[model samples]
Target: MAEARAELQKKETELTNAILKDVSDIVDAIGYEGGYAVILRSEVVLSAKKELDITGAVIRRLNESKGKPKEAPKVKPKEKPKDKK
Candidate 1:
């Protein structure tokens, strides 16, 4: 159980890191294209003007890059053991 839990956690971490890296790359591109001097996360700042926020643009770009979602792989169910008397 512990081993399975650890493996799941590792996979989750890897997936999260990959997603963050992709977002960072997209944001960097947006900044370069928009001539932004600096971009800060909303969490880091107390408040910022809506006009300064490029989150919508970033999301739109991300969606465009992603295109259509791929179908997930199908998993087969395990069979129950049969007992013979």
Candidate 2:
């Protein structure tokens, strides 16, 4: 029974370590500035921030494209009609 108890404790510690690792990874990905606030306020804020950044990047690209003139698609010159068969 003592051996079984030791095994259980080991397993519990492993599980706790795994959870902490995941949380740390999440915190690191979210960054330090607003990450703590998001964790304290709402857990979904991290995902929201990620999505907002993606959307903002896409919008910025689209706006930049709109400001630039579209280039004509390049067409390679035909090979002189294949120089006769």
Q: Write the per-residue lDDT of candidate 1 for residues 2-81, one digit (tens) a residue.
A: 99999999999999998888899999999999999999999998988999999999888888888978899999999999
What total of clashing residue pairs does each candidate reach? 0, 0
lDDT of 1 at 63: 84
Overall lDDT per candidate, in order of appearance = 0.93, 0.58
| Model 1 alpha-carbon drift over 4 Å, by segment | 71-85
Q: Candidate 1: TM-score?
A: 0.76
Extract clashing residue pairs from model 2: none
Using Cα atoms with residue i matched to residue i, what is each candidate's TM-score against the true structure? Answer: 0.76, 0.38
- 1-85: candidate 2 lDDT, tens digit per residue: 9999999999999999976675555454455544444333344455454443433433454456448777999998876655656
